[model samples]
Target: MSAPHGINPNIPHSARVYDYWLGGKDNFEADRRVAEQTMAAVPGIRESARNNRAFLGRAVRHLSRLGVRQFLDLGTGIPSQGNTHEVAQAEAPESRVVYVDNDPIVMAHARALLTSTPEGRTAYLEADVREPRTILEHPDTLATLDFTQPIALVMVAILMHISDADDPEGLVKAYAQALPAGSYLVLSHLTLDLIDKRTADDYVAATSSQAMHRTPRTGERISRYFDGFDLLEPGLVAVSKWRETPLFPDEPAWMYAGVGRKR
Candidate 1:
């Protein structure tokens, strides 16, 4: 209906703010204002966003190396460095990637930067992660990915926005059920597990807007989101620890990243 809705620049979107934190040029002043406030509350907020982006590339490379050639990346913010298709296709030139997002601005930019290698494919769909059916049943998703084979369902730095009212667990289950046995669920979520309450509250207040509602969960609660799957080595830890090839150590992001396989 009316293409859902157009971009609202007055209100800060979490994705755009995250883009700002990542030093991208696609974000507006409203996003930058909130991002600066979040940084004031939690100084490591920018680092957290950077580490999460790095974790996505590492996880995608690992999965692609393990032979996953298809991907469904949800809540894909404005395309930045080390995007899903780039990382996956780096490991295997024939990788097929499908990106899903609700932001019109992201969709427009996704159309530009989410390209693929000659042997690979990359496509974007403007859809919300809360609606698993629409993403799973979309013609592009069905056509680009083969359910009979293994695929990586990437949910990086996005689930925390799903409030308790939405039954996030049930929604995740629906997506997991649609995948084959060997498919992987790669997710990184914002958490209050390691951060102080003051920082958490202030950070939420600074960033929460009409476009985004913050809900930072605990380590235990975030683990429950992986109930039906078998977690990989080292399990769910900080995003910075998700199988990266060693870099100079950095502060904890207070976010958890994990890769789980549908068993």
Candidate 2:
């Protein structure tokens, strides 16, 4: 079957692979192959994906309860249950959300499924995360979000794609500088901290053929991304342990997650 316009189903996309990990039916064979390979390498990867998603929901809900009604979700993946707008708007009907991603498939799926409440609004931006200014200046972003008010900047499990040379910290700081005080930065990243060198090498070998540009950073480095933000309770920890206590505490931490508000 031919893929949709502007989409090459033959080439695996990170977002689609992620959708496969989340058990969503929006992925193609290429994506499933990579996802399955990753699962084979890191047996706990699928569970870790679910945990990261749960962290997203928890962070958004926490910010909403704290009265943040606007959201700028960068690297917005394939829409599934508990999307940012869905979770935020459910808490406050007047919430406004701007979903941004560079992938055509992600934008298409988001536009079709990430609907907004009549009282709230949702806009999709076909943009890359590396260019924070482009995203902040996009007309769709300006139309959907208020720069003056607090906005939650959500970047989940996407930074690993950014190479170290790209200065991921500087990219994050650019966005942080643009956001108003009181805005929240909700971020989660893949890490190799709690696992052995062999396991990390195995994971890299499994996905290396997929042309994925991933860099799993240390928890300390990931925490530095939150520079000026005041981290909420239970500061940066395994995604499974962020706010939600884990049933299996012995599992190796595959990802680090946290929520912080600009100070």
Candidate 3:
């Protein structure tokens, strides 16, 4: 009922750290420091972030073109160029979007800046992905979306922050179950599949202070999230290889991304 906690500049948040990595200036000193440390652990981290964001844009545009007009974007981080709604509405002006995030700073900024096309609607909810029901059943979401229709559930780069103990697969299922048949689940996750074990371990250790954990899953483990759905082409490939741009190669990025249609 009450508003969530406000931004604590003292603590480093994963979203703000990611914003800093993408060359955005919205991060605090703590966030920047941690981001730098993580980057040091994995040299390609900043480029990985940029590529992951580009993947998000491409996926949203593809889904929008497919007639998926409603989007539930979780872990909606600090607004940057080419966000979900921006890409979706660019293709279909009437696409409705519901951006959800636990971060109060993201909530504040989203409220002030994540605007939608006049024909469409956009709403922000201060909610956590772990609490999928709260987000799916929230009044704001109920008013903006029709669950009976095909909706796109986007969980990009955020699941890595969730530890295995949090049951990421279960959380994904919970949200996916709320959507109707023909809906899609779009995700891009961090994996150590490409890097050395020591480097991955160091990267995980660097994020420990912020309650962030990385699960470097194999392609098989990552595929579990789409258990009940039919995967799109090039199923469960590295983020860089998922319908990639001309610049991306067959080689894997540090992240894995895929989309599945609920059958």
TM-scores of all predicted structures: 0.93, 0.95, 0.92
Which digits, one per residue and each the tens of the lDDT, describe model 1 over residues 35-125? 7777876768788788888888888988888899999999999999999999888889999999999889899889987888999888899
What tens-digit string does per-residue lDDT give for candidate 2 at 157-240? 888889998999999999999899999999999998978888888887886777657788998999999999999989998898
lDDT of each: 0.84, 0.88, 0.85
User: Considering every candidate listed, which one attains the maximal lDDT?
Assistant: 2
Worst 10 residues of 2 by lDDT: 244-253
Q: How many times do residue backbones clash in model 2?
A: 0
Candidate order, lDDT descending: 2, 3, 1
lDDT for 23 in candidate 1 is: 85
TM-score of model 3 vs. true structure: 0.92
Task: Name the weakest run of 10 consecutive residues (lDDT summed) in model 1.
Answer: 244-253
Q: In candidate 3, what are the lDDT values of residues 47-89, reduced to their tens digit?
A: 8888888889988998888899999999999999998999998
Highest TM-score scorer: 2
Candidate closer to the true structure by TM-score (higher is better), 1 or 3? 1
| Model 1, residue 105: C-alpha shift (Å) | 0.6
